[model samples]
Target: MLKGFLHHYYAFGLKVTSDWALPCSQRVQPTFATLEFRKQQAAFFAARVPRALRSQDPARIHYHDLEDGSRYLKWRGVFEFLISPDSQVVFGHSLDGAPAAAFRSYMLGHVFSYALLGFGIETFHATCVVVDGEAIAFLGDSARGKSTLAAAFLADGAELVTDDFLVLGREGKGYIAYPGLPRIKLYRSMSKHLLPARKGQRFTPGRVPKYLYPMEPVTKPQPLRAFYSLVSPDAIKSQTEVRIEALAPRQAYLEITENTFNVRVQTRERLESQFRWATEVVTRVPVKRLSYPRTLKVLPEVIAAVRADLQASR
Candidate 1:
């Protein structure tokens, strides 16, 4: 039973359902209650959500509220989310749900999936590279160095496309522009050697994350020309660099599967769909590996190399 309500994301049309009913039944309700709850929640999310969120689309931002009651449930992770082409769903346990972990997996996966689906376009869980009116995406595992590379590029004067995710859209015969959003997580640990940032700068241990320069103006997405993942351990010279090259389809699939956090839940169809997306991305935008080192001094060198490569390709 839901004690709260459901809401939809204004810009993305994400639907979220949650429990609002107090003292909810421990057992699951098959039909009536569930349906009623879903409807009510949906309306709640839709009606209450403002038209503008984080100054972006007000219509696309959606959320849910649950009243599981019983704070003793101690549920830390209790949420779920699902991503389909046209829509997405996010759910969380009521107060009685007991633990966030209960919802972490589902919610996280659904969010990741939504990000991957391109927020209605094609999206990747990585930083974006914008150059020559074009955008390239970097995808990888949590600590694989995508943000480091993006930061590296930024240090070299390239405009930031997006820190984490970007929405792709059609533009003048080619798809372009990153969607919305800002602020990428800089793992305090990883930044130790990756950027010039200092340790204490971060609120806690890990990378010294920072907002993009000229913060007042939001970075816009441009045409996409390439997608790369930082594989770590590329030949290190006095200066590290992002080596861009074409990858065999097999290798691309392998790399994507390896980087995917929820690989097991990815069904054959889902896998195929992902592959199809990857293939399309590869065919249109070259996919490559961005291998570099833990040094901030060499960031410019890496960005320079990418710029040179883009110029050469153009």
Candidate 2:
């Protein structure tokens, strides 16, 4: 641990201590931290070469696995994160004078998700929310409106559990979804439509920027109830009505596996274990296909349909 003054935070069921300010709940003197983030000298990373490169894009973002069990992630011309073998400590170095917000954007996202995988947590690329005391997750590909629907849920009085990265742990016969960072990323048009009163900070700069809006987070884990795999209406011609269809166990397992985070790093043994784990999950939790038109006007209707589905299942 690089010692000076460290900030303690709690997220995804882990107590974290970091040299930088994390956008999570702060805890004073946390007992037995589960993870630590420290700043390391650039020369430290410069001296080491990657043993196995995992990512396809070397110029943008690359994932490297070292022979010593440590992993390095580099965002070209921005920042890099080195995660310890035990996944307990993360050392970061900024490159090209990147701003603090940029560093944090990658840290809370890619870095944190990678660490969760190392810790043996089942991580998924999904946005989750709390509804009637149970956790509901929305899973889909990019531009499928998972975040937009989640933002709509938030406006309809649902609590944000996590956005983009969800970690699950076994609890009793079911799984519990842990709380993630207390922010949601939305496109500018969606931000204006759903959160008109709230001012959003642009985390990624581009011609079309995604804005991050901070919301009150659900600190405690909630029982995982259902998984909704969103289907774009454009894929189904003339499909105007929102539809929810229950998936069979085999299909559910496949869907979950497809949405799992950090699949490239998994060994054969790990992959087999994950397959079994996902099978067990689908046997307990329900997975459904949620299809609807990609439009803001029908958001309320979509939310009502989901609530009805959940209620009917219960």
Candidate 3:
């Protein structure tokens, strides 16, 4: 026995060799058909690499295109990952004594996002909920309450599609939102208030205080019903009422660009494709700005207003 574990991350079945436990909320079998794991021997790079995707000075996180055409990534303190040239498989290596929780966290977030991008699927820094069988996504930067609002929707009986990384693709003439891994990362304060039924576990023991709330995931891709780019708090000055404003096509396109999770890795071809997809998406679907006071007490009102808006759109 290789001593491996099997799980489903988003829609893909993952066979992991790392010493990590799969989420308790989602059902993962003990076996898998397709496997991705770590390399036994580490690879070394030359001092003067000819080609590189992105590299920081301190070299904490870097992407390299090796002579063999594989993609290499290093998350210094966490893990290192390599994506096959064909983008069919991923190889990962967790730092010595690295907790599996931390490995799972970065895998589902940045590493997986990069791999999906390599495979030509676009991901957004957004969270989404299923509203009446379709996906209603909330897009924004960090700390803009994307996850909290998703938890509110989940509390209101909507199934969660994703919490942080939202994968999307085009279906027919409109866009469809793919289901992500069945987990939600919530801060302790928000978890206490929003996720009462589900038990919360720390995302990673020592790194972050956020708790991961695993839930029943919506596995199939759903048609994107609407997209809301949450405005930053400073953008709304003393706003008491929840405001929903339809965004113009240009504005929607810009917001989409900003919220793209792997915008930096986009090549020229990818850039053109994203632009075309975004343009078509904005025309076929509504994109709006959802703004309100960042107060937990008013969350119910905000959720009610969002539902009303969605209903009216339909």
Candidate 4:
């Protein structure tokens, strides 16, 4: 199901494939083929991707069309690339075999979103809710309630910028944050908790083998003041207070490097450059580890503390 409003992304053209089989909208949105390949495109993806990933995931067809002279698909990761009549490029995998197109698109999106941020803009996997003009990002692993936390901030009057990713760059000695890409992904369980339970809805779009989700209707991002890592409590007594600690460059590098979208596909030189950017980001921003109780009850307190921390630093 197309969850939110019928929004358009003026920044970039899109080809979407929905599991619910939603019909296309305008010239920009078409759920049909162009003039060439029909199911052959799917075979291309199937032939190129690995058997294991394919078995684990059979591409579900959504959207396929010609745009900007490139045939694009929003597909179910069922088939490997045989000869996707659109591209005729022949998509294939290495020994380890790449993930399906759906998974790879997101990872690729993140890398480019950050790299293309322009003039020091960097993307962070976090939920950014803008409070009083500054963006406070809630970073966490899947099921960590990043969006739930952002929603809490919104209820408390914070504006939503990006639910899953944030772009950070320097405006002066201070930094400026920008929103990159649209769409927020949610798990069925998580979606139920955050967006209200819908009958007969069993899974989210990026469910099963994937953990990342994208959110849209985001506000323009502002400068990043801090970075937080969401982790579970270390001890029973450590429940109430979130363990917000400053992060060193080495630690930030480790976290961002590992979690970056398709960090492995990046060349060695690119990896080093990203690493340097990570360090510069850590040094530029007040990076911290926000170890809080897993429940949503303490969300407000956490946001308040973050707000106060920024105020004090200022």
Write the residue-wise lDDT of candidate 2 on 1-314 in tens digits: 34664787888778888889888877332222388889887777766644334233557888777889998998887888899999988989888799889888788878887887777666788999999888999998777788999999999889998998888888899988888888999988998889888788888788998888988878778899999998865696678889999999889999999988666666776787788889888998999999988889989999999999999998
Encode model 3's per-residue lDDT on 138-185: one tens digit a residue. 999988999999898888889988777887666787877766667888
Instruction: Please give the CA lDDT of all the candidate structures.
Output: 0.46, 0.84, 0.74, 0.49
**How well does model 3 score by local distance difference test?**
0.74
Superposed model 3: Cα runs more than 4 Å off: 1-35, 43-57, 204-208
Off by over 4 Å in 2: 27-33, 50-58
lDDT string for model 4 (267-303, tens) is: 4655667777777666677667776776666776787
Q: What range of 10 consecutive residues in model 4 has the weakest lDDT sum?
A: 29-38
lDDT accuracy of residue 252 in candidate 3: 91
Q: If both were scored by TM-score, which would come out higher, candidate 3 or candidate 4?
A: 3
The best candidate in terms of lDDT: 2
Residue 64, model 1: lDDT of 26
* lDDT for predicted candidate 4 compared with the true structure: 0.49
TM-score of 3: 0.84
Q: List clash counts for every candidate, in order.
A: 52, 0, 0, 28
TM-score of each: 0.58, 0.92, 0.84, 0.58
Between candidates 3 and 4, name the one with more favorable lDDT. Answer: 3
- Model 3 lDDT-worst window of ten: 24-33
Best by TM-score: 2
